[model samples]
Target: MKVVVRVKLLPSPEQAEALQATLHACNRAANAASGVAFTTGATHKFALQQHVYAALKVKFGLSAQPAVRVIGKVADAYTTRTAHLDKGLLGHKGSKRRARSEATPIRFRPDSAQPFDDRCLSWQLDARTVSIWTTRGRMKNLAFTGSPDQLKALAEHHQGESDLIVQDGMWFVSATCEVPEKPLNTEPTGFTGVDLGIVEIATTSTGQRHAGRILNRYRRRQNRLRAKLQKKNTKSTKRVLKRLRRRESRRARDVNHMISKSIVERAERTGHGIALEDLKGIRGRARQAKRNRYTLHSWSFAQLRDFLTYKARRAGVPVVVVDPAYSSQSCSECDHTSRRNRPSQAVFACTGCGVVMHADTNASRNLARRGEIVWNAGRSVSRPCPSL
Candidate 1:
């Protein structure tokens, strides 16, 4: 399994200046490469390298490896964007079309793309520093640190390349490492259905609830604070607003980690496979209903599910995703699907069987049933469920 841990860097003044300069050079080279790629319709890495590589090294003061990395970054950027663009406009992004898509002009922003491989960047766990290939030369043994847990991972499981990121005027390296997954040996006890939502973070078929009310309250307070800050329009206020946004995001992420950890731990202890609703792209699918749109539009279902998945994989736990359609509206007791079954956000009353339950809990039970069907149909095969 691959996990990324961010470590804070404590570089000397000279090292910091060099760091900024190297990144600035990379930015200029990437933008130049993006321009050349768009103009000559050479979005492929080899074609881009042939067209602009030598010039980038000489002009931007970048080394051979950084120059190659810059062109590769630009090519990746265009490749990602071209997926959403019309096929006919794949190689014609530079053309003057009647109405151009957002992907038409492939431009790179300052400090947008910087990638380093083993050749350009190396980790020094013993010295608690890193060596980065720079314009001058390799910036060797630049001091850095992180939490003990993160540092332990760096010392133990460090495997892949790391990204140098500057956010909120701080330098940090996001280190990716490959770690062996935890071994779990347990027979199947049953299946636990999990319902993910905005109201509460999760509701399990076993009647467990992880509330997200605190996070919601915090977001509301921040929204009000931001609105008040925007009225001033001063430089300090803008900075404060930006810091506020980052702080709120960190809080949400921390909460998600805690909730996901608890959920996975419970499933592991109970020896049950987890069943979850397939809610990918749920934000785009939600209606623009005035009161609910803000919360729905910003739901973090994807983050929670991702956390669950990695944790489950590490523990050798089973995770199954069932179709979300009618999972909430269908009665778990009678198997009757109805729009009226869920009359309110929190209540679920089956008209046919007249079984009362929490809306999310009922949905979770339905998911559990789906998982049972999958397990029965193919006990020998691990991929029993029709994955979403």
Candidate 2:
């Protein structure tokens, strides 16, 4: 299986400048290719390559591989926008009318990672440095470091593209690495259902809670800071806002990673499958009562789910995703479904069974039971089941 391992990249100021120029040049080539791709219906990577490869190299000073990579970048952008319709869902025909053939001139995002080839990129463990091809020429011996564990991974088992990216004024090399696939997880011996929510990052059927108090508290503080910064409308304020945004994102990502790792470890230790709600489009579909929308809307349920998946797989624990509908309202004890049963966000008292429990925990228990059922039936966990 392929996994992306992101590591810090410390480059000389001159190297950074060269890298930025290469990014701009390639993005310019990509925009030019995007326009032609849409017009000529050359959206496929191979076709886009055929149409733009020669011009990209000549017009943008991109070498052969980098020029081809530009076409891939545009193709990916187009592919991402069409992925929803490409899933081959039952009985769904594609749109009868096509989008405007005219492609918008796409600008390269500063955060865009330049793809690397073995010829273009190399790493040296002895020096803790990276060598990368840049616009001016090949840049050798740029310094980098990461956590000891990350450095260890870089030194061992690193594979695929180590694309260079810049974030919040720091450079990073995101590399795809190979991991040995665990034998398909055995049938679940038991299940631990996890309910992901805003107030609590996660609540398990076993009654363990990963609280969101710190996360929510931090976000509230961030919002206040951003509000004050936005009122000024000055360059310095803009810079502060950008920095604040990066800090909050990093904080949330770290917390979710910790929570997911803990949850997966717990399941592995207990020899149980981890059950999670099918949370696709959760932000768009779910509604929080008045005054709670901001808190619910911004939380990272999706990221937590993804982290749980990979971690659970690595530990040889099955991850079962079950239907999310009525998960919060349904009573796990009695199988009763009612909105009234859940009196508030935190408490659940089932009218049918008279069983009282933490609302999120009850939901998690329901998810856990549903997951076991799905696993026993030997079905894929991704598809949503309405009655589970």
Candidate 3:
């Protein structure tokens, strides 16, 4: 599997200036390439590269490799846009938003991330430094730092291009690493079903609950602060808003990592597969009041799912996704299903069988049962014929 390991770059002021200039030049070249691609309708990589390669080197002071990278980035952006259009992410056919998106040329931010291949960037894992090409010239021995695990991964498996990104005035290099996965466990003892919800971030069929109340409180406070800052509408307020946004994101990411690690480790240790809800398009399908919409949208269910998937894959743990419909309202014990079973957010009472349980736990148990049924059905089909 390909994983990205990000390391912080601690550069001198002059080096920072050079890096900034290089990024600006690259993005400027990208914007120009996008314009040509849009006007001429030559959006593929080679077609766009032919038109912009020579011009980028002459006009933007980019080298051959950087110029090519800029063109490739523009082409990739167009490719992504085309895919989104095909998937109707922007809007349906004849929608004003779709037409407006299709009409305009794509633009790049001045400090957007730029990729550097081996020719442009070299890493010294032992020295914790990197030699990279810059607009000023080649920069050598630029110091970097990362966590022990991240450094180890980079040293052992780092491959392909690394992206130079500036976020909140900090420089970072995100290096791609190709890590090997363990052999998958085809025969699992059982399955652990995890129910994801707003109140409780995760609840497992094994009677484990990861509450989200603290995180929710923090997010609510952050939201209030953001509103206040927006009301002020001052330069300093904008800076504060950016910092707060980054901090909140980091906090949420850390929490999700911890939660996922614990869940994956337990499943691996117990020789069990993971069961999850297939909750795609949840935001579009679900509706809430104006005030509660922020809370609903702010839930990081997708991120948690992604983390679980990759971690489980690495641990050779099988993961099954089942339909989430009525998972909460259905009775885990009696197989009864009704909307009234969930009389409240936390309680689940089956009117048919009078079996009561925690709402999230009941949902998780239902997911586990569904996952086992699916897994068994597949096993039976895939089972080998009897010896003749």
lDDT tens string, model 2, 246-361?
78878999999999999888888888899889888877787779677878777888888999999887788888789978988999888999989988889999999899989998
Task: Please say which candidate is ahead in lDDT: 1 or 3.
Answer: 3
Per-residue CA lDDT of model 1 for 263-321, tens digit only, reads: 88888888988888899777768776697777876678888899989989887788878
lDDT string, candidate 3, 83-175, tens digits: 999999999999999999999999999999999999999999889899999999999999999999999999899889999999988999999
Sort every candidate by TM-score, greatest first: 3, 2, 1
Kindly report which residue stretches of model 2 are placed more than 4 angstroms away from their true locations once superposed.
82-107, 379-388
Off-target runs (Cα >4 Å) in candidate 1 are 86-105, 182-187, 375-388
Clashes of 3: 0
lDDT of 3: 0.93
Q: What are the lDDT figures for the candidates, one per model?
A: 0.84, 0.82, 0.93
Pull out the clashing pairs in model 1: none
Report per-prediction Cα RMSD to one decimal.
4.8, 5.3, 2.2
Candidate 1 clash total?
0
Residue 383 of model 1: what lDDT? 52
